[model samples]
Target: MHHHDNPPQSVPSSPAYIRATWGGTGSVEEASAAFGFSRAKGYDLVRRGEFPCRVLRIGRSTRVVTASLLRVLDSGEPEYSGTRDAHTAPA
Candidate 1:
């Protein structure tokens, strides 16, 4: 079990909420919260290079790439964004 002075923010899974709430980058805690996990686990994943999305380490600070996080969240979509329609025949 893990504990924190401040719990992570429970961001909605919707893309619109992600776009509206986060900028180009956000904290690892926020990313973990989006996935319904603890920040410690998130940091562990980051250290092991197994995080679900891209993470950048600048000096002692770690930042999650919002675009990568959003991509991970959008994985359930039938077709990737900017890709051809899934039901359409190839040209």
Candidate 2:
């Protein structure tokens, strides 16, 4: 028999969960990293409403909901279209 220290599990990261806890608002870095996007591209998306638009702005920070990102990923909604070659942003 084989012994395992940890069992396989499925779970999103803690920050991802927390950011969506209050509906929507993810740290720029977290959101960027979550979707394998660069900081600059992430900010641009935030501003362009390309991804899930930030529900609120707090001081100098912004947050994006994980749901918005998921929606774009999960569905083929025309509004959430992306031009892969046109932008160096990550998938």
Candidate 3:
């Protein structure tokens, strides 16, 4: 079994715009960046069942649905502050 004791792994931060173009399976950082949040925030959201479940895993990594993230962003209509600005908050 996978060790639940170990903290989750992280993905490299990719450009949000490019991530938006990816269409599916985004790294956690890519999704988080689209939401204008830190990777930690993304994990927290996942813990809270706010983000899409990981569609795939590579080694110690997780990949989320880019389409889901984009749909989320589109539905939320965030201002794209790239920070925790309530005005820029995702729907």
- TM-score of each predicted structure versus truth: 0.66, 0.48, 0.50
User: What is the TM-score (0 to 1) of candidate 2?
Assistant: 0.48
Q: For model 1, what is the C-alpha lDDT against the true structure?
A: 0.73
Candidate 3, which segments miss by more than 4 Å at Cα?
1-16, 19-23, 52-60, 77-91
Q: Candidate 1 residues 1-91, lDDT tens each?
A: 8678795665465567788888998899988888778999988877656678877778999888889888887793321221223453433
Candidate number of the best TM-score: 1
The weakest ten consecutive residues by lDDT in model 3 span 77-86
Summarize candidate 3's per-residue lDDT along 22-43 as a digit string, tens digits: 7567777767776678889977
Q: For each candidate in the order shown, give its overall lDDT on alpha carbons.
A: 0.73, 0.55, 0.57
Residue 22, candidate 3: Cα error in Å is: 1.9
- What's the ranking of the predictions by lDDT, best on top? 1, 3, 2
Residue 29 lDDT in candidate 3: 73
Q: Give residue 51's lDDT in candidate 3 (0 to 100).
A: 56
Q: 1 or 2: which has the higher TM-score?
A: 1
User: Which candidate should be chosen as best, given lDDT against the real structure?
Assistant: 1
Model 2: per-residue lDDT, tens digit, 1-91?
8778786543343443544453554566665665667889978876654653332456886766556655544563523324333654654
